[model samples]
Target: MGLIDSHAHLTFPELHGQLEAILERSDEAGVNQIITIGVNLSDARTAIDLAERYPQTIRAAVGFHPHEADSVTPADLHAMAELWNDPTIVALGEMGLDYHYDFGDRSKQRSIFARQLAEAAGRPQPLVIHCREALDDVIPLLLEHGFEGRRVVFHCFTGSPQEAAKIAQHGWRISFTGIVTFPKSTELQAIAREYPSDQLMIETDAPYLSPVPVRNRRPNEPAHVHHIARFLADLRGLPYDDLVEETAKNTRDFFGL
Candidate 1:
């Protein structure tokens, strides 16, 4: 069964530095497509390059991470806007709120999010979102912008069923990561089971939130996506192979792959 690692940082130092081996392992595990996220200005270039060099296997998302919220400049957004046309750059995010660590000022984070959204206006691509303790603001922003019909994926979803319902109602997609495989992820499991398969996706979010049975490690790899897929299958009462196929198709459709 083929699967897509919908969100990952294969452009990052650790993984990108050894992409030959990484791609080999990912292929071995049946991970055919991956979305490389651009966390900041420079990251946009690397992700784009990676995608261009591996068009069939890799794609990229252009946005500034909330941690770099305070440093986001107009020039940075402009740079991302320029790369929007590179067929390899498929989405506009991995951007949103992150108040847990407050790596950057909260207000600055909000402004950056809005600015990126405005910059991406009229563009035909899904938004890769990353929200943490900011749904109240995040959800409303999407509504205010009338971000309907545009695919928006809540990457690494940590929200509840109610939140999932709201996002789903808006026609936005939700992508689950390795976190769902954790033992205390009952809430996530429940939501995954309830959400329609079309609105669902799978990602590794590698070098960050590695899935269970392997959470202790850092710099997670795309191959771990299989574990997340298995968990989702159990959650939805579907066979593992069937779930993989559906998620793969969903990922391609969500990102217009």
Candidate 2:
């Protein structure tokens, strides 16, 4: 089976303009499917458009990012809530806390997160969470709302093993980005090596954290997921093809693709 990029931002300008070539390279590299994430209303619509245009290979997730939470108006939330019913939208996020940047007020971020979590609960859809240095806050909010039944995933996970275990305890999955391949990511690699295989998945988070061997080479793309999968295979001491099939299956099962 080919690799599935569980998370990416193909609608972003870095990769959007040359989608044809990007997708071609992705397909050639054995990356079959990609979920393009939308951090706000505009990108959400754009993501849907991209999915529709590339129906064979792309799916979409829509929600306001925590960084953009402060500017989110009631109308924007309403619009996103309405989008929950759109058949093409597969998940509800790219949302959560971001205390690392403190881009938005912590309180505002929490409020926005809770609001979106309620919408996700209402629709009973999976969530693509983005937590950075705020798991302590994010975890409680998710639990307080009783997300036990939700299929939530921590995207671009770069957390301690304890944090990973915490997420897994809640029956949530964690997706690793190219960052896990960095030489300095020994701790992350150890986590990946020991994390339950069924709860593990890989992504490129393209147009962002490019994997090593091509670090800072240029804007990342879905095609680079191969590097991540290979790195994980070596880390976990599994056959390369086996890792590919396993992660692809995890991606499909999680997103219900």
Candidate 3:
């Protein structure tokens, strides 16, 4: 079975126009499906359009990232609701807190996040969250706003094992990226090994975080996911194909692909 790049930015400018070639390379590298993420209204629409264009190979996750919290207008949320109803829109995020940069006001970010969580209250669609240096705030907010029974995956996970255990304990999933292959990311790799295999998944988070052996590479792409799969396979002591198949099944089941 081919692997899935569960979180990527194929709609981003750096990789957008070269999709055909990039997709070809991805296929050559054994990538089966990709989920492109959107962080704003324009991005969300563009992601939907891309999914429509490449329906067989791509899916969309639309939401306002915390970085853009202050700029989000009521009209934007209304537009997001329209897109969220589309059959092609698979998830509601790339949304959460980002205290690292704190690009937007923290209070606004929390409010916007809670509003979206309300919108997602009983929906079947999962959430693709981007949490950076704010798990303490992020975790509580997720509980306070009613995220108990929903599907949530923390994309591009760089958290410690304790944090991962808590997330897994809360019945949420965690997705790893190229970062796990880094020589210095021993803690993350440990989490990958210890986390429940059924609850674990992998991604490229394209246009970013290219793995080792190509750690210095620029504008990372979905084609590099195999490196990550292989890394995890070695770390977790499973065959490469087994790791791929397990993670692929996890992604498809999680997103209902």
Compose the digit string of candidate 2's lDDT tens values, residues 153-177.
9999999989988998898888999
What TM value does model 1 have? 0.95
Q: Per-residue lDDT for 1-257 in model 1, tens only?
A: 48899988987777756888888988998899988898997888888888889988998888888898998788977877788877777898878899888999999999999888887767888898889888888887877676875789889998888888877777787788988888898998888788787667889988788888788876799988988998889878999999999999888888888
Candidate 3 segments whose C-alpha is farther than 4 A from its true place: none
User: Model 3 — TM-score against the truth?
Assistant: 0.97
Q: In candidate 3, what are the lDDT values of residues 1-257, reduced to their tens digit? A: 78999999998888867988999999999998999998899998899998999999999999999999999988888788778999998888989999999999999998888888878766779998889988998888888867865699889889888888788777888899999999999899888887787867899988999998788888899999999999999999999999999999999999999
Ranking by lDDT: 2, 3, 1
Cα error of candidate 2 at position 254, Å: 0.6
Question: Which wins on lDDT, candidate 2 or candidate 3?
Answer: 2
